[model samples]
Target: MSYGILSKLKLAWTELDNDQKEQLGPYLTFTDYREIWAMGIFLLGATALLPLLIVTIIHYQLIQTSVNSEFILRTERLTSNTRRVVTFFLDERLDALRFTVNEIPYNDLTASDRLSEILSNLKLGFGGLTDLSVIDHKGTQLAYAGPFKLKGKDYSRQPWFIANQKKDSYVSPIFKGYRNVPHIIIAVKSVRSDGTWFILRATLEIKKLMQTLSSYKTGRYADLFLIDRSGVLQTPSEFYGDIYQKLPLETPKYSSRTQAVMTTDAQERHIIMGYAFISAKTTDTPFVLIVVKQKDGMMGVWRRMQANIKWFVGFCILTVIIVITIACTNIVNRLYHADKAKAETMALMEQSCQLAAIGQLSAGVAHEINNPLALISQTAGYIKDLFVIKEQYRNDEELIENIDSIMEAVDRCGRITSQLLGFSRKFDIKTQNVNLKETIFDVLVFHQKEAQYRNLNLSVDVPEDIPDIETDQGKLQQILMNLVNNAFQAIDDGCSLDIHATREGSDFVNIVISDNGCGMPEENLDKIFEPFFTTKARGEGTGLGLPITYGLVKKLNGSISVKSKENEGTTFIVTLPVRIQKEKDGNENSIGG
Candidate 1:
């Protein structure tokens, strides 16, 4: 968001190769870059999270299916086991009736007192027996015993009696018969040698049958009840309804083996229902053993596990986002600093090219001015010669003096042009042996007049022991000229300027230029050697003088430093090697772009 943060973002962009720029040109703004970052996150997130989501979905389905199957299987198993128990109980009661009809005589069964005694003994031995009855082939209730009293009751129209006539043995579903209480009956047919037949019937308590089914444990929110084929609940149900209530669930098709299925109940609770059909041997009405269990109870662990998986996936996404943001920030920061450095380097190269162009133009202008100055000096010298040779001009001292002054002015102009030529001629280093003291005087030539006019005291202190350095003559001269010029301009009338040169050990020389003038602030010292950095008033300085001077020193295997304090004085120190080492020189090809 801040300029300082994305400052070099554009700079780095500019450095891209041409081919890369053509392809990446769409990314031209900060917003575009940010969009790219967001898109990158999206792509990476999809690559990571898509798989996770797919796996979670697959895993969820598998777990649901497995739990569903397991619950259903359990329901069916419970129903089947309970059905066996109920069937076995019915078989025992039927066997007892069959045994009584075969062993007891028709006369004994027809007597109420005799049948009552048999019923009491049967209850004591087998249990759940409520009463006994005798019926001749004519379907008349000839006798009865125990509990309810009935004598000579005819039952030819009853469904159980009619069904019993066809089967040797029969068992009926639980129902309220003549006594109007829930009970079941078993009938056995007896055939005598005279081709006569009789039926021995026994009544069993329905409570004992219910107890047998209810005793088995089902699961939570589960119930075991009997339902007839007509969808009527024959026994009490916990959630469906009481006995004889029309159940909401459809009656299952009769199957000897157990069947399990998942369904929703009246309350919209999911339930797993398992059922087994019990076929009545005598009556057409059949009953089903039904087991109901809530599905929620069976899959509690799966629900908890699903919740945990969601949390884990959510956490993983958050971590990925955090990691992406941090990595992008770090990469962008590094790119910013690197591109900032490159941008600074490019500016320096541009400055060098500009300096070289100015140097070329100066050389052209100086050469053009030299021809006129040479002609003027030649004409002035000829006039002075004529004045001396001819008698009429020889006495005219004023004319002679004017001619001499004209030649002097021409010479001064020539010297100015020569300084320009010397500065412009250098595109590369040219080394020469030179006298240090004389070289300083040559630089001072253009400034000596100003020094005198300003009444400034100038001191040159060069030790004789200091040897002439082997280096580029033009570069060394320019270095001296710029420093001396700056020193002169910084001072006022009567200020003392000092140039002190000394030998630095055996290999180097030191040129110290000191001026007691208005020096710059301490902070400006570091930037003084940077191109276009200056403390001077706007138009007076291009700010390249000292920077150029510093660069020249570096090219000549030398170093430069400056010390300055505001309102005090400034000193420039230039250290040069006594001999230039060209074979080891590396600055020649490093000047500019």
Candidate 2:
């Protein structure tokens, strides 16, 4: 059903250039008219919004790029600043150790009193120092102060001791050493004139270093921590892992300057990371300083901005579509009305021209046809004269009646043709004594030959009690003639026509003419008497017969109505006044075109 409607609409939308379907926008029905409105809105909406969407997307991408770049740069800058602070913390402690080792005599540095004094001063000055120790050339701890009992401890096989043999100084990563507490060592070597060396080692607790890192500002879900080259956390983390535990993340490759990248954690949360491998100038130890932020948290502002932009764009699109729809509807409505007005004007012009041609044609045809009618009327009159002069034929009542009927028919024909010539002329109402049965019989006389030719059954049911009506005999005759003529045309061979005359009341009478013909559908019954409306094929009818009949009935102050069903039959009922009911100034009445 939908496709069928669409196909018809499509056909209505397109037509040949030579076709006369111009300016008739597919508004055959109200539904088609609304559908056209929808089509216009859809097309115009696409036209208006396509470019808007393209531009919004392009700008969204650009703004996203700018926001992401800003986040990364801010992360790198924070990491770089924090790394400097950490580097300075380690350098200050290491420098204090270096100064103490170079200035003190080896024997004095190894003395318990001297080392004990040094540990006290170091603790008072730097505050994170846990101990001071002296290791001899053989990797034995010769002296120690301020921490656990290690006065004679051996450290020859330790990694830190082994590393000291290769480098001038070292800053060890946080570890649980002999004391079994988290600490970092800053070691310095002192050489004697004999080229044998001993080391001055200072141990710093991890608490102060962890405190330093915690002071930096970060995001809501952010973490700042240090990791070694092997991906081991040196400082405690808020999220990743505790100190000395392996990080559940891929270790970043080393870079001297601070850099940042995005990755996911073991728990599958996205993270933004900034890292710098800080190589303290005074120590060989390097640690990666990383600042990690939740990817969702880091882009909070940008995401909010994106959402706002989307909502704004959506509102704009809706507003534009609404505006376009209203505009298109207004434009289409105006066009439709203008075209309707133009079409009506064109139809009126065409109808006026047709009426003019009909007026001229009727004049010419009436003159030609009236000549034969005049000859027949004259010949019938001369025959009546012969019948009157001869007693043998005059006394024959049937012969007299036949001759009179012939003259009456011929005179009726003459008046009809004359009326066609002046189509707008008012008919004269010649009121006289009208016998209803005799008038109906006289009208049916014209159809007898046709009824006999088609073998049609004709019937009339009129009681003799019907009173004579005082009406225009000529119009009464014509009215009955047209009704009976239509009935004859409607009925097929061997079909039937039924005519009945009955008094409607004391003042009105009804004449009913019915035929068993190919009846009119119910939809067309109302419009059957309208001018230029007919169901007959082209050239078979002029479509003016019933219109004239209806007007003539109205002019006589009567009413006409029809009832029919498809393939059944049609019945026309005419109600006429029983007594003479003249119009105001009846002699001056006219039927307007």
Candidate 3:
């Protein structure tokens, strides 16, 4: 019987389709499932955070470079624009002086009125012009404007006079004026009507050029300033305080002459210098229009790039987090349910083995008790018949009392005989569609005599509307009979047993047998599924009852599980399929033998 239960348990376990099988597969143990979930969660979390971290770093670097680049470029442009405006102003002033030098006929001028009129017009045409002078071929100041009262001071020894002798126009390097004005001299050569060369020298103020460059600001990190060819500050500098302050003429010691942007500091403050020469506009003169912009001033561009990068990083992080969370949650949920099903299946398997062993033992006891019981009943009837014929014996109180004891013995024997026949018979089960509630009631009727014999209370708890299930009648009867008997044996006096039936899932009906009996310990529960395992005393049980019941349940394509608490009670739950196939898949093991 124990072997039968084990076999049936193995069969029922095997009969499960893919979904049920997966829920109880050996590999899907709780610990293994937990580990899988843990790994999934870890990977998911990493997926979310890693990309964000990477993007944030890259964004920072790119913004830093881009902002720095933009600042330097704009600063260089500002410097160039400043130089051009200054050059144009100087060129125009020189041209005006040249016109005066060429038109003021030294031969026709009887007085200084002609030169004065022309000088005033030239001064009015240019905003920052300080002085305009006309020098002859001999370097003599032919005419002068403003406070310079000289009419013929230079006689031809000045360097600018010498250069003007051969050039159409020229710009002198920045120089300080005798009158303490910061200026550059613009010279132009003119051919007088006498066929002799003359020079026009004009002094242009540097402040006006500085104001042109300072007018525009590039973001917060960009401030533009100019450096002259000699590396002197040509435009008003925030660091040096004035346009006249000279910077170190040589490039920084660490700087390489690559046209790339660089970081530097003016007066201890960091700046991004975009230095480029005005070679395109300046005609091969050792004059560079250097543009320098501060690094910190370009923060607006940097900040914008940084902001974009931050948003990108944030988006990536959010996306990863969502994806990982969903994946991990799904995996964990599946594993959790799978492990739960496996646990229930394992428990059912154990209980089934325990019942089968008890059934086998009980069947043997029932057989042994049957013949003696029949003889006792026949002998008691004969004694009663003799007593009836002998009126005197019937009237005797002692004899009547002995006869009553015999009759009582006969009645007990008959009941034991009936129990033996029922327990020993290997029923031929007839399968049909039967309501699970009706089946529970029928099983209770079969157990009524046994319940009366043991003085045990039995109760049935089944819902009225339980769906009909296809199962063998005899087999289900045998299963229930074995279970009730075992429940009676497990408990002492004053214990009650409850049998319940109900619809479970869509395709299964559930029956639960519960008893407030002496339950086994946890350790014994583990071994209860093994063949011949029993907690019953010697001569009381064979431990085959549950096993046989287990076998019958399996044959009907059902499952069973037992939950027991020591000193409390035990519950045996059975889940039977509604309609079992006649020919199950070959992979399913046989419940029989």
Local error of candidate 1 at residue 307 (angstroms): 5.3
How do all models score by TM-score?
0.64, 0.63, 0.59
Candidate 3 lowest-lDDT run of ten: 584-593
lDDT, residue 260, candidate 3:
31
Instruction: Go through the candidates in order and give each one's C-alpha lDDT.
Output: 0.78, 0.79, 0.64
Which pairs, if any, clash in model 2? none
Tens-place lDDT per residue, model 1, 35-110, is 5555766777788778988988898899889989998888988988888787777777777777787788878888
Residue 446, candidate 1: Cα error in Å is 7.9
lDDT of 3 by residue, 443-464 (tens): 6787677778878888887776
Top candidate (lDDT):
2
Q: What are the per-residue Cα lDDT tens digits for candidate 2 across 140-259?
A: 999999758888889999899999887778888887897689888879877779999998999998899888988885656778999989999999899988988998888999777789
**Cα error, candidate 3, residue 513 (Å):** 6.0
Candidate 2 contains a number of clashing pairs equal to 0
In candidate 1, where is summed lDDT lowest over 10 consecutive residues? 23-32
- CA displacement after TM-score superposition, residue 8 of candidate 1 (Å): 19
